[model samples]
Target: MTKLDITKTNRAIENLLETTENPRHRFMLQAYYRHRYLEIAGRYEEIFAPEMMVENPVYHFHALGLNVRLEGQDAIKNLYREWSETGECVMYADDEEVAVSDHMIASKLTGYQFKPGKVLAAVGIDVDDENAMYIYKASEEMVWPYDDRCRLVGEDVWEVDPDKAEIIKLDPADVITASDARTMLEPLIKPLPPYDEAAMRPRATAR
Candidate 1:
């Protein structure tokens, strides 16, 4: 919510793609930013329309705590169309990667989470080399489905799919990697808060 988090997110994205040397990854990352910024800027028509979007786009995710896969441009367009009348959504993530091959690029993402609006936190998306494919994911650390991005079976309370039912996971511990003694001290070595030591240091006195 603070001004710092906004600037921090943009810088984080730039840093994430700084090391990628592949041409395909570079181009995709560029397009990713362009399309995303367009959405964030309220130009949803430019990217969500049938002509702008790829054919048969598939949006896969857990809906109302169930794995509900939304397919085709219609699914993505309709979702945005409805939200656009209200307020479209946007998402931001860090540590994003694009692994390139001869044709397709697979993205490895973390820190997924989504805010309200029509933003699609994409992931593991591909539609052949000749076709368009782009996947996004919010920081899993904070994103949730409360906005009801996925269609609910009924109104009022949320219903769970018995076969694939689950609830929100907002706690950091939920996604922590397996820990051992060596890694346990990570917090100890973590960088300290920024400081102004020059001002804090005692002024030299004439002696």
Candidate 2:
């Protein structure tokens, strides 16, 4: 019931990469960027790709009156599995602001999540049709911390304005499954080169 044009998102990231000159920053972004593509493709195994994360990875989602934290790889994996299966993660962002450091990547954006009317109803939103599609929009920020190896350690997400979140119903024709999106988006995804410390190191001139 949710989808994204992966081609478009890929191009956006490529453009950002082109403008970013920091080797470490580019390295970290490139290292973790493939997860979303694999997620869309229903390839969760590749998303984790052994050593992609630390032994105990955590994800904290702070929204509205709720604070949810998923700890450990299993917990994180199960959540992603649920999102992929339910198509809840089929969303995009706008006005994105991203920053990188030796150990973290911070992002702020206006995020839009697509969901079925039924899902919204379960959350106490009144919907006229259970089968109808609806989109929820909110401003969000996420802090991603990685290890020296550039493996992700955890994520802290803040829903900046959940109280002001908006839900808009969409036409029935807008319905699209995550699997279908993956099929359409996979072709446009360009694989990043394998990690090479030598390649990722900041040059002496840059230092």
TM-score of each: 0.43, 0.85
Clash count of each predicted structure: 14, 0
Looking at model 2, how many pairs of residues clash? 0
Every candidate's lDDT = 0.34, 0.72
Q: Give the top-scoring candidate (lDDT).
A: 2
Off by over 4 Å in 2: 1-6, 10-12, 198-207
The digit string of per-residue lDDT tens for model 1 on 97-145 reads 4443322324433422222212222322222321221122332311111
For candidate 2, what is the TM-score? 0.85
lDDT of 2 by residue, 126-203 (tens): 788877777778898989998776788888989986789888787656755677767766775556566667656544
